[model samples]
Target: MVTVSLPTPVQPEFDTTIHRRKTRPVPVGTVTIGGGHPVVVQSMINEDTLDVDGSVAGIRRLHEIGCEIVRVTVPSMAHAKALADIKQKLESTYQRVPLVADVHHNGMKIALEVAKHVDKVRINPGLYVFEKPDAQREGYSDQEFADIGDKIRETLEPLVVSLRDQGKSMRIGVNHGSLSERMLFTYGDTPEGMVQSALEFIKICESLDFRNLVVSMKASRVPVMLAAYRLMVKRMDELGMDYPLHLGVTEAGDGEYGRIKSTAGIATLLADGIGDTIRVSLTEAPEKEIPVCYSILQALGLRKTMVEYVACPSCGRTLFNLEDVLHEVREATKHLTGLDIAVMGCIVNGPGEMADADYGYVGKQAGYIALYRGREEIKRVPEADGVQELINLIKADGRWVDP
Candidate 1:
């Protein structure tokens, strides 16, 4: 069997001072949501927002799993009422995790009612329309369109003013499939159209003198999402508005495909220092999105307090059940935050391969292993206790402290 040499690590371009975008900081409760604070990893709760117990339970679970901010969809008056109770419970229990109320249709009313309870409000631009296109094609025209815009403005005005007076923040979320018909008609259905829609909202907020805000220009299509945000950034720069940007690809499917698509859109913007916060919208449970968001941020070196696991794809040169062992160890240590562990099949170059790791295990003589920190061999252990022993070492090393 032919052996493949491990790939060499390319040295990163060195910079003494990391350049960060200069932005106006926006506070979401106790946590500063934007402006050079670490990129916030946010997730929406899947529980019915009207179910206070269920929503609170979901929020608590997400908090325990390291989700920083939790959003819940408030679809009606019942959900709006639950928001106050949920916020009170969360504040008493998980004091640090802020709750955002996701408002779409009737956002103005929901935003007004829930403003006092939730930390933030997410307004999706598409929900302002009262009639579907099919209904519109039969008869609706200028009057209906004008009424919709006027009603949207009227609905939004009080909440926007109240939030500003109370110093609360809001996120104006614009999705690709949900662009305002007015914007689509004026700019055409493209990135430029999306950017213009976002600008319209920004202008609205600015006119209301509401400076505490965040903006999102999301598209299910990655390229469109990227282009819209890029154009929005340029416009923000030209207009001198420094509102923090919330990044994501909306409706990014499920499983591996979702993760990849969200990562591609988020990473592209983050690498260039464009995004301020992110949410990876997936078809999966909201809880599942948290870890993926953290992973993306960790991989980008934006987040450091998570276990970094590296394992080899076993081959003919491997000894023992490498795949099974590694899989078990990975799953077992999914909650082992802030530790860097490596599991390798062979010692030939394994030690050299994982020099950046805090601790690692490599295969040796039958039922034996080499334990290491960097290139130094720390100990030899039986296969049965190898994973346990590594965990103990990491705990003792003070690399994985509880937050």
Candidate 2:
């Protein structure tokens, strides 16, 4: 009998890092997504594109606070033309900011016009080549489906060629709520429908020799959103497509639940190494979304833009008020970027638990706290001075920076 060699089983202990999916680099202004670049953060301004002054200020505010790419809606030809003034004003007053124009619903002319003013253009697959809903229709015949596909190709070609010639990129954004009538009839309201929707547009762009594409599959419900993106990645892998992805949960509402909901979907895919850029869509000010996006990236160790605090939950053995000390420590060290600081409740688990931190504060006894520099006990200071002492230790080690 011939012997068969078995594949090696995975050792999870050695698999500590997230290996991002391989994607070709797609440029958006000066920033590049995928191709092993640090995951990019993006947000959209709510200002109307026609309000040139307001739009310029809005884009500048978001970009100043670490939003790499900003998108503005272009619902009409007037709004599309305004992007030229907005782009010029941004350069003259502020700095050159990467802008994307969102076009929808028979928007070919608007897209071609706005393509001249922005670094990238985003088109919805379901709406770009609008197919008026037929109330009398049962389902599309195979011939009718092919007919619509041809119409889409004819409409999309000019915009594709314009962006390709300019070396700009395009986002084939597919929303679950807006699947085309034909796509819905063909694949039903499901993740398969979403994947097929993006794939059709991608193939069209590929045929035109335009590959600077980013794809998004967004749904209001987290489960549907998650399934759509995962399915898209699987389909792209099989087809040898290396386009980057833009991750978000559409209509993620406002307040605590919104942040949690967006995080649950975006972070889950990010952990699996699926997304190259992300936007945390919230109903609050556009500025509010930037911090949430950075927080998600930081928590995953994908990008370190802020100080990392590792604090233990208080137990009966906790010496001092763990909550109060943690707050104080955080306030002092929050500006120290790329540093990991730990605050522990007591000695029982403090040193052992915080072994990986750059610096740690542990309660050693009543009215006293011990400081650590990577598992080595530095000194014990009075609890009242613990926060200041931690700051001093960080400064002594040359890691402190003024806020």
Q: When superposed on Cα atoms, how far off is each prediction in RMSD?
A: 6.3, 4.0
**Reference-based lDDT, residue 232, model 2:** 95
lDDT of each: 0.80, 0.94
Cα TM-score of candidate 1: 0.83
lDDT of candidate 2 over 1-403, digit per residue (tens): 9999999987678676898999999999999989999999999999988899999999999999999999999999999999999999999998999889999999999999999999999999999988899999999999999999999999999999999999999999999999999999999999999999999999999999999999999999999999999999999999999999999999999999999999999999999999999999999999999999999999999999998889899999999988988888888878779999999998898998899999999987999989999989999999998888888998898988898
Which regions of candidate 2 are displaced past 4 Å? Answer: 1-12
RMSD of 1: 6.3
lDDT of 1 by residue, 1-403 (tens): 9999999999998873335567889888767766789888888888898787888899898888777878888878778988888888877876757778888765566678888887788887767434354434433367775676677667778888988988889888888897766666657788887777677667777889998888999999999999999998898899998889899999999989999999999988988888888999999888899888888888877887667888888877676689888877777676666667888888776877788887788896678878888667888889888887877776677765443
The TM-scores of all predictions, comma-separated, are 0.83, 0.96
In terms of lDDT, model 1 sits at: 0.80
* Best TM-score among the predictions, by candidate number: 2
Clashes of each: 0, 0
lDDT for 330 in candidate 1 is 79
Task: Candidate 1: list runs displaced more than 4 Å.
Answer: 1-20, 92-97, 129-155, 331-334, 364-367, 381-385, 388-392, 395-403
